[model samples]
Target: MPLSNNKSPAATDIYTISRLNREVRTVLEEVFPTVWVRGEISNLAKPASGHLYFSLKDSSAQVRCAMFKNRQSSLRFEPENGMQIVARANVGLYEGRGEYQLIIQSLEPAGAGALQLAFEALKQKLAAEGLFDEDHKKLFPLFPKNIGIITSATGAAVRDILSILKRRYPAANVIIYPTLVQGEGAGIEIANAIKRAERRKECDVFILARGGGSIEDLWAFNEEVVARTIFDITTPLVSGVGHEIDFTIADFVADQRAATPSAAAELISPDSAEVLIKLKHREEQLIRTQKQTLHNYQSRVELLSKRVPHPQQRLIELIQRTDEYSMRLKHQVEKQISNKKMAMTEIAGKINELNPAHKITQQIEKVNVLEIQFKKSITRSLEKAQDEVSSLSQLLNTVSPISTLERGYAIVTEPKTNKIVTNTKHLKSGDQLRIRLASSEIDSTVDSIHEK
Candidate 1:
């Protein structure tokens, strides 16, 4: 707008809308430096230009406020009408319209309301399911191969984790899976990045991290998909979302929970030099125990040798016992032989006293008497034979012819030396002859007898 020069007999100076707006902006900036204003939000408009135009009022008065796209991206949660909030902003005039409003730089909850109730309800629901149970939590790997990070690539949380992991263990590897950590569809993106890392098997462990913000700002980690994905991950998870006081569903289901991005790095890997020293100490202990065992065995061997007797002494004792037994056995056998000899002598004397020779002599005398009786029988048989011979001779005489001559019958004889009157021839010769009657004998040599 053009300004009039001095002297009141003048025409009005015309100013363009842009010129007036610039002048008003200068005035408003000077009157109100950047400040914090508390009010209830209403008539909120979110247009395609990525800007939020809203009015903040109490019961009686209201003022317009604007949140540009660049500033809107910084808000962690959606803004709506009838929400009580405290806006930290600067008072300014719109260059196009010359209207004054607060250019909000930051925002926060003004009172405990719907948001606080929703927070408590979610916390209770997840807690009842044992999502926050320590027993179900996986212990972060002591030596992670590659730690995955799911956060904005340019965020300070990434730089913090990388710096800490490198300083503690220089050899540890890291992989970043970029994701939106807040706002619409951000929770899904954060969950998807975690699931993709698991599918790819790219990292041994994961760290979901972001710098501290309002509860609304950290709500992405509290979403259902992000929480379940952390619970379901095969890779061990480490959550370092927000500050120490901040808690989310991801923190409860994660394998390990760290209070900050730097703390998460520490949990993943510790100092290498300290681990080496502990191993060396264990090795020394084992060596000492083995040496003690060897010494004990050697002592036991020496003690056992002292308890055993020498072989020569054992043999000498056995020989003396054998000699004593041999002498006793020989004495017992000799005594038995002497007793047997005495018994045999007594038996021989008894046999001699019982002889039967007298009885045998008596039997021989009886046999001689029987022989005498037999001889008497033989003499009687001889007498009987003589009587038989005499009888036979008498019988022969009774039947003889000479018996007739004896009864007075005469007989003649002729002989030289006998005479008989039988033949006259013999008488002529005058031979000598003897004749006898029956009573007498006749003797004749040659005689002639005459025929009667």
Candidate 2:
């Protein structure tokens, strides 16, 4: 059945390598729009550009794959070599290499759901950073003035929150920052809403809430951005994302976590009826205290009235006492004047006795008599003294050393020491001696000394 090589050939289309690859890519993309492929990942390479290049393979075959940054950013868990994965991708050909490849639009871990894995991953991350720490959590406002709600405005969560708030505290004002609670990009929208509310500074507390839903529906609150935003804002936030059994990352990161949106409203809003009852009790206590205080004051007024005298009677008593005191004072004054007159006379007589003129006269007479007596006694004493002086002078001359000297008695003394030479034991040869005469002293040196 072999045909001859020389047979006339029919005209056919031809293509260059680039044109062939382009046509192949177009054909592959048109044939396989988007598909989910399951395989073990291998030779995974994540470049600085954030594009992931890898080979998805099974025991029998393999295929090349590339996930760009935009799609890879949405991946819940990191893709590693040998990790099983499911990739939603478009089949296409690389024009440069002319190789068939899968352009991944999304990726998920093979066994677990992507949203659940993402939630667990983010929870762990934020928990490790202490964002879910009790110390970082703020206390819910007891009586919030303005409550900011970051949730869908049209959802049942808002209606529940509003209804509970109205019933509990009509005074509280609600400001809604309408946000997406589910679906793509919902996390970013929720995070942005929190930031916007923060910048506006409208609420005393924030209730980031949503009604009960599946993990996918409530995934926005579990996002890292939303959790971090809730952590960063100054206002207290209450997270009420789902039913009692369900927990979101927002619940862990928020200031307070409520089981439901209605519960969150209850936590933030004060109970008006309970508050009124307390106020009423306080009012009763105040009234009772005031009445007791008024009674005490009235009792004191009555007691003071009994002790206080009538004005006219008090005035009459004062007037009568004044008259009696005036008469007694007048009588005392006259008696004092009479007594003073008598004392003045006595003092005058005593003063006259102490007068200087009378004293001077008596002193003059006494001085004249004493002068005469002194003169007579001085004359007698002078004569007696002269007589006694003559006798004493004769006696002195008899006992005086000068008299002894004049009588030829010689007195000797050591010249330098000026000591009398009473004992010859104290004198030594060659020592200078002084002979004391009546009129003069003679200096001499000792030639010999004899002890007697």
Candidate 3:
């Protein structure tokens, strides 16, 4: 393509496509400067280069736009197809394609600020992924040894946090990880500061804080990179961003959320005065217990002392009692011997009065006298017995069977039965018999029967 000189008919200026497009781009940029274009986004394309290419169209027509990587980095909300947006860009022509398009510098949703929508969108995303889950949250150390503050060193947030922490617990070690909390690339700097703190491993816990501001001023904390970093760190984190009502993605993802920077300090630091008071109370209790134990031991020692006896005194008392018992036992033995001696003497006197030799003499004399009397009586009794015997003999002679036998009568008896055979009827022939005639006896057998 050639550019013709309108003033000189014979003069001609030839141009290449690149040169022509360059001139057009310059002209459009110079004329348009920076303008706000409001329309519905369509055909949105985001490539790996981090640039956005889209068309902004209304009811009748549309314009092509290109947002470069540097400019796209400034976008808060993601541009989507069919979303109504207002882009602040400069009119320009694409040098390579020679296509007319707007060079977008900034973009926002039609109804809401870019930062707010971005904050809400990221908060929702991370929440859905359980980044803000209670299970993922870490508990703040009761007493953090080293506390890292990720904020601008000169910002009021650091000052407030330091003041409160020092006042509550002066022993706490505080470290400041200085970073930009607002403006361009603040999010990157903030996220990098967090990483550096993690790598250093210096702090027991982290306090991500900043002064109160609008959403835009507090935009770094709301960035996805910063939020994800807070969620991923092993160290416990407390987010104190903006005012009490203001909240960011960092707040949702951090382990604890404080209303302000001072509040975060209060939450992390323990009160030294209260702890000291409790320690003093415990010390007093221990002292009182030890005193009570000592008193009890002393009382036991006193009670035991009364029950123990003096060794020498107790031995002397036992020796005196033993002597008294020995004397009593000796006296009882002497008295028993004296009484026994008196009883023996009385028995000896009685024995002498009835002497055994004298009694024997008297008994012999009486025996002689009785012997004479016994002889005389014996003589009389002998005479009398003789007379009686004679009379009895005469009577026996008259009645005795032997006397009849002696008078020429015979007695017959069966030899086997020794029965008398008084009648001839009782005698049997051939039976053996004995016949007694006075002093003689005859043995015979019956030969004849006699009845008389």
Candidate 4:
């Protein structure tokens, strides 16, 4: 073959196959940088490096492609051979292998043939917004008073939820907020039912449920509208859609996710048998505790009763103490009586030793003699006092005013103050005076007075 569009080179112009392949690689690099190519994958290889090596082909032709670890890590789902894919890649040649290939940067499932792409797209979008995050999830209540159901009124999901709710907690009221479970308007209808249940205050919690179905059949529950409605509802939400392996948008947005409708009911309500068993066990424990406590108190009372003395024995001790006190008192009285008698006898002996009658006669004789002497002395004294008194009386009479008057002496008195005037200082000229005689006084005016 010619290297250029000329005749084959002789010796110097001919290049080896490797050199030719290198020329082809250089040309391909110049022709394409990165491009989009659609094909089905085959012979896929994933090694320890996490790089993907595969061949992309149509029925007519095939090309070698490689996705490095960085590009492979970006894929949301695992890729395999037979997966119809659209790859964005740079065209290049492997120098070592001397082969032409594409170095892939990214790949996606071809929409015209993809089955799970719609679901993946929705999942990615919702996940980006944290609708599927555990932090936003509400814990299922340990006890639910009423369970509101948003599902088809005639669907199997409703019957399953009701049966489980009744079996677990018969007291819980299960209200149905019926809605269309499938078809065009199903998402809006389900959202509306949730809102209505909240507005009506019909139930403490809600469950969005449906039986198993194809992904397309269950798409209503997976709609963003329904998921958002569950998130915004004030009542707690529990989602039970399809089977255990099935997941939906509503599951991410709900407060609780259950694999089946019956499981959702069981998650929200308490188990009847378990509760009853606990209650009965507690009751038995309480009764046993009360009986033991009563026995303890009764034993203490009986023990205290044994320690208490009898009333009759206590009375006997008190009576003995009283009798001893009485005997002591009687002895004290007799001793006092004997001591008094001895004292009286000693006084009588003293009286007898004193010769009372003879002494009394002597005392009487002395008193009589003293009385006679006193009378004689008193008589003589009386006679002498009488004589002296008569003489004194005569003397006093001589000094008396009446005697003085009888002797021709008169007492002069002042008429205003009734004072006797004996000296000239007591009398004033022109002062009225009275001359007191034995029986009468004559008034006079002090004309003159002489100094003593």
The best candidate by TM-score is 4
Local error of candidate 2 at 73, Å? 35
Query: Per-residue lDDT of 69-132 in model 4, one digit per residue for the tens?
Result: 8776657557887998877799999878887899998787786224345666877998898877
Model 1: worst 10 consecutive residues (lDDT sum): 351-360
Model 1 agreement with the true structure over 106-167: per-residue lDDT tens digits: 77677423454466687788789887788877766665656788888999999999888766
Write model 3 residue lDDT over 149-239, tens digit each, in one string.
Answer: 9999998999999889767766667899999999999999999999999999999999999999767788888888998888778999999
lDDT of 3 at 37: 77
Q: What lDDT score belongs to each candidate, Candidate 1 first?
A: 0.66, 0.72, 0.72, 0.69
Once fitted onto the true fold, the runs of candidate 3 whose alpha carbons sit more than 4 angstroms away are 1-112, 312-452
lDDT comparing candidate 3 with the true structure: 0.72
TM-score of 4: 0.49
Query: Which residue runs does candidate 4 get wrong by more than 4 Å?
Result: 1-128, 133-135, 312-452
Model 3 sits at a Cα RMSD from the real structure of 52.1
**TM-score winner, 1 or 4:** 4
User: Model 1, residue 387: what's the lDDT?
Assistant: 42
Of 1 and 3, which scores higher on lDDT? 3
Indicate the worst ten consecutive residues by lDDT in candidate 4: 395-404
